[model samples]
Target: MPSPDRSSDAVTPFHLNVPEEELDDLRDRLSRTRWPERETVSGWKQGVPLDRARALVAYWEDGYDWRRCEAALNGIGQFTTTIDGLNLHFLHRRSPEPDALPIVITHGWPGSVVEFMKVIGPLTDPVAHGGKAEDAFHVVCPSLPGYGFSQRPKEGWPVPRIASAWIALMKRLGYARFVAQGGDWGSAVTTAIGASGDPAVAGIHLNMLVVRPTAEDLADATDQEKASLESLQRYMQDGNGYSQQQATRPQTLGYGLVDSPVGQAMWIYEKFREWSDCGGEPENALSRDEMLDDIMLYWLTGTGASSGRLYWESFRAFGSDKVMVPTGYSMFPKEIFRASRRWAERQYPNIIHWNELERGGHFAAFEQPELFVEEVRTAFRTLRTS
Candidate 1:
């Protein structure tokens, strides 16, 4: 284990060991769930379907094995380090290849470090995963402050602060030069880090590119740009309710999420159905185990409120600045917001790679790990020369 940085606080090795009693309690709660009348409309229009919610809860109570998830996390080398008065939890898996590049992979709202579990092996130990040793990366996946195992911030810790903390984390780990990759809010933080003019941040890769266009930019938009704008507008109209609730009143929402396991599950599960490339059901995109494993991260840690608080801090604050570093973007077809190459280039002047992927959605890594790994590898391959 790496020793603590005495100047700040110790970088203590951490493990996942939720108590048996908590698991029992969760099961009991699921068993005693108070039912609500089914939605009048068909499908997921109103929310997670009543039948789907009940079925998922039943499996969560009887079939889910949190211990397996815990062991998998522990197996990947978990640790906590105090950064800016918060104990930040992260998975630090150094590549076996000495020359591998250091890269920090960040997750956004409704996601934890578990998002990168499948890609970790391929990135950190490429040879073991049927890749060349030269393609390896020292992968670091941190739970954003106030999410997962990380301690909640007493005050606001927005995207810029989170970016700074990430840089500090990389430096503390003896990485003088590193790259960053993220999607969703992770994209915001990575963009901030790239734009901060930190020489340590060699480059960044983003799956979600949030761009703001001026009136003139919108007036002369291409077909793709116009379509992208329309999609965003639709989302702002119909899909933004949860965002608005979380940003304005996360505390009120948290009560239900924290108190009812079914509530928390449905809150996230709805996003999986809506945001994923799964035609109608999220099961088409991720396995039942995969979805439940992610939910357990929130439920076990009781971070329902704290996790939603990130939106409160930075939801309305996207694309405030331009990123000048060598940047790469992978635009998944089903992402909530898609930026055309021209629009993206306006914001990211030094974009080296931009690809519109055919599959995947917001949770790119979790939904399509193989494609996600390829995208990451391809995005940073040239930057590795630095």
Candidate 2:
């Protein structure tokens, strides 16, 4: 396919045709990975264990098929359009129900639109999935500007900027009034969209709610708030090295990630395990094939550095004013930072729905798609009536 023309608002049809050489090179690299010594202690204290790494790498070379994922994306109706001088690739699947609400879903680092595959069909066509017509959504999942199939940025593209692009994107797609939803970095952008008070947006929803609790709120914290605080502290201390590196020197770290298929797999695989409530057993959360498919997006696109640059561009500056629009939040127990309703209310004053789920984690849609869909449909149900 010709490279996407970047000068116009044309939404061009797109297809994936991974050359045979790319897969051949990936297999060769996976086969030749220089083995690392086993951890000094045990059970993921140092990082991904040597044995686990070997198992995944072995399967990545022999068991995973990238063609299946390519076909799935194409079947979902992928397209590319220029927004803010960048070409964005997105999956757009309209519901059979014409009145279905249009919703844009965003993905975060180490994740691509591939993460939402399990929930898209169920969401876009609720009747086929045993849901009422009123619950249907015209789903749009974008590969974040510097991630997945979207084009890389030449300069800073922060959260507010991305949120603006998404607003324009939805309007360009004929959605005059729609809701927004996201998690991870997507949560930041979605929140910014609501904060923009974009007249076209009806409201917003987030599985991961990021909020800063003030001293006054902390003084009157509940048990749930205390637990949330503990989780946040742990992440600040132990789980944020990757964020720091990405925010500071992504290009320096990209060489190994882009060069070694095994390196890229483990970097993301570790997060999938640690964040998805499957602490010691990653395959318990996602099959090696599923994990490898997400890895291939990073590997084939060679976007390891470009994707991380979003962190460098917006990490410290990723916050929003109080969102006055009707908001909905689902707090997953295993998420890196589980904000209490009161804490979230500081940023989102008009919360219409709040549910503290007993299961799932950061990759909510990928790990627990059924629950994720339920939360989304229920959260937006009230907004639809208005």
Candidate 3:
């Protein structure tokens, strides 16, 4: 429990115990949701299918359990520390392996720390999950300010600011040096941290590499680069409506999402379907309970507006700087945007590891925990020794 005083550096252990009344209210809201008529087009073209939405809501109201998620979070060891006047929440699990490397994994939009739950065990205790002792990590997964349990900012919390906070966080935890990994907004922050020339930041890795292709590069593009461009174009044309709305006018969009559990569920649910390797069925990649566990973080905290507001704050800041650290990247096929190795190497001049994975998607850890864990272990192994 962090003290009420603002800007305090006092780190406090935190436990999650959502009131029973809030659970009751969530069920009540789910029961009363007035769903719109089903989409005219087939198969998620219009949005989350009406039938799927109703089924998810029905399960959420009846079958889903928040207590399980809460207990899991507490079991993982939750904590809070006031950084820059915001009470930031994070999960810190120290490895039993003596020489474990400290690593912070950041999650992006439509996600919370819940994204890393499956991978945390494998990452923090590799021996327990069938990996080498050398692959073990002291894992820290933070709720990005204004996203999950972290305190919402009244104004100004762009990506760089978040990166600085993370640097400070690692230092506060007695990690004199560490590596970083992330996807989506997490990639941008990790890049910024690597770019900061902070000796404490040993290296970085990203599942989503953000790099702008030059016109010259496009003119002489390889087949893979051409495919990458096409995928990005499709996203810009069709899949980017949420970004435009959240980046420019999150407040207007937040009202409905904040007030309605169904709205928040669908908003995130659609992304899980479209972004994962699930092939239009999100449940194929993640269980209903897993999805609801994440959704509950937002619904329970009433952070629908605050979370979307991150795009408004830092949407345009991606790929703004080059990273000089020994960077690594694992490209999951279903990620929204991907850059070719050559293009990415130019931006990340000291790239140490680069692999284009055959399976997985935007939510790498959540959808394919084994693959994600392998990628991280492979990426940061040298850094751990160096």
Please state every model's RMSD to the true fold in angstroms: 1.9, 1.1, 1.2
lDDT of 1 at 176: 96
- Residue 65, candidate 3: C-alpha displacement in angstroms: 0.6
lDDT of 2 by residue, 271-352 (tens): 9988986766877888887888899999998888899998998898665567999998898878988887777777898999
Predicted candidate 1 versus true structure: per-residue lDDT over 100-207, tens digit per residue: 999999998788899999999999998999888888999999999888888878899988999999999999899999999999889988888898899999999999
State the displacement of the C-alpha of residue 375, model 1, in Å, after optimal TM-score superposition. 0.9
- After TM-score superposition, the amount by which residue 364's alpha carbon in candidate 2 deviates from its true location, in angstroms, is 0.6
Kindly indicate the candidate among 1 and 2 with the higher TM-score.
Answer: 2
Model 3 residue pairs with clashes: none
User: Candidate 2: TM-score?
Assistant: 0.98
How many clashing residue pairs appear in each of the predictions shown? 0, 0, 0
Better of 1 and 3 by lDDT: 3
In candidate 2, stretches whose alpha carbon ends up further than 4 angstroms from where it belongs are none
lDDT of 2 at 265: 82
